[model samples]
Target: MIKSRAVIARGKGEPVEVVRIDLPEPGPGEVLVRVQACGVCHTDLHYREGGINDEFPFLLGHEAAGVVEAVGPGVPDVSENDFVVLNWRAVCGQCRACSRGKPWYCFDTNNADQPMRLEDGTELSPALGIGAFSERTLVHAGQCTRVDPAARPVVVSLLGCGVMAGIGAAINTGGVTRGDSVAVIGCGGVGNGSIAGAALAGAEKVIAVDRDPKKLAWAEEFGATHTVNAAETDAVAAIRSLTGGNGADVVIDAVGRPETFEQAFYARDLAGTAVLVGVPTPEMEIKLPLLDVFGRGGAVKSSWYGDCLPSRDFPMLTNLHQQGRLPLDKFVTEEITLDEVEDAFAKMQRGEVLRSVVVF
Candidate 1:
């Protein structure tokens, strides 16, 4: 067993703390990763607030990049000292989704068979099956996607979660292409990622919608061609007006709320796609006109991790970042130590930072 210091949320509505835990050696099909950097994501906050489940004493943090310290038997894809970005969707090749050639939606994703435990032998439910907010962690071998060693861990780590989701929502889910006009609601990390992805996909116009003026400016930096302050303007109307009164070709709801989704539903052209990348609470529900739904004549899709295949997307994105085409580093709002995770959460709630990464 290896003794590692990690961040844990003891119970619902409790503040997270750094605690020592016992991490067992990797078993077959598993690997031990020495986490170099982990991003403090909103999912971690959801875990703490019991929004995801009643799994208390949860191990938080998943967006991470690290180096493989050891690999268990039967692991041939990676070796010791390999730089990697950790992903939650470790696709199981035999699942029905994988059999259909849609491995990104694999029903049976892989995780470590053994558990990390507190000193008293309490098992931890790792957030998103990763729990990478530690000095080191144990994960399925497939969770580690090898990336270029030349890229900085702090920069590339964001690709493990929000950034990848945003980009994928535009390219994969929204099918954004040249001459398409895209509008993304919410200008957080994921929303900005959609903006960047839309630009990368050759969209003619990228409109950013957010109540915060600061985030709107940040969206522009990520390639948003227009800004819609939802606080001062009707998002759907602004989007339609910006698209020459026809609405956008693709509209994305990164906020994941009933109101925002309604805006996205109405803010698209007759045949435009609408994507929901943000996570919504279970109790949250929306009522829409049945006629409107039928008349819209477009698809309504939900993006799970941007429907990305880590093995295919990670290395390609890392290469893009290395070539100076993608500004992955711009997502890092600050670099903090493990102890500051609680404070970082507060800042995140206030929308003060895009990402406060824990650098080990």
Candidate 2:
């Protein structure tokens, strides 16, 4: 057993505590990782709010970059000392989705299958099955994707979740390409990533819509060609105006609110793609006019983990980061020790930072 300091979330709507936890040696096909850095995400906050599930005592923080410390039997692709990014979807190759060659949609992705517990032996449920808000974590071997060792862990770690989701929503899910005009609503990390992805894909124009001035300024750094303060104007109208009155070729709703969804619905050109990368609560229901749905001949899709295949994306994006193509370092607003996670949550709640990462 290994005793490691970790952030422990007791139950719904409770603050996390810094405490020592016990992690067992990896079982077969599992690898233990010494986390270098982990990002604080809204999903982690959601887990704390009981919005995810009933599982309590959640070990939050999933988006992380780490080094493999130990390997269990039968793990072939990785070894000790490998620098890797942890992914939640450890795709099971024989699943129906994988059988059809779409490994991204694998239905039976697995975790370590062994429980991490507190010092006294109470089980700790990992957030998104990774739980890297600690000195060490054990995960399925498939969850660890090796990347270039020279890259900074803080920058590359963002690709483990939010940044990847945002960028992939435009490139992978929405299929943004050269000359396409894209409009992104809600300029958070995901939204900005979408804008940058659109730019990287050679989009002719990328419009960022958000209520926060600071976020709008940050959007420009992420390759947004134009900005709209949604609070001061009609977001849909602004997008249409920026797109020469025809509307953008793709409209993305990254806020996940009903109002933002409605704005996305009308902000796209005819037959343009509408991608929803933001998560919403079950209590939120969107009402769209049936006529508009029929009139809009485009696809409205939702991105799960950016419809990503981590093995395919992690390496490529890391290479992009190394090549000075994707500005990953900008996403990290600040870094704090694991014990400061609670305060970081408060800053996130106040919209003061893009990402407050925990560096172990």
Cα TM-score of candidate 2: 0.99
lDDT of 1 at 215: 97
| Residue 263 alpha-carbon offset, candidate 2, angstroms | 0.9
Tens-place lDDT digits, model 1, residues 1-360? 899999999988988989999999999999999999999999999999999999788989999999999999999998999999999999999989999999999999999999998988999999999999999999999999999999999999999999999999999999999999999999999999999999989999999999999999999999999999999999999999999999999999999999999999999999789999988899889999999999989899999999999999999999988998888888899999999999999999999999999999
Where model 2 places Cα greater than 4 Å from the true spot, the runs are none
| lDDT, residue 185, model 2 | 93
For candidate 2, lDDT tens digit of each residue in 177-223?
Answer: 99999999988888888988898899999999999999999999999
Worst 10 residues of 1 by lDDT: 321-330
Clashes of each: 0, 0
lDDT of 1 at 55: 77
Clashes of 2: 0
Per-residue lDDT, model 2, residue 355, is: 92
TM-scores vs. true structure, each candidate: 0.99, 0.99
Query: Clashes in candidate 1: how many?
Result: 0
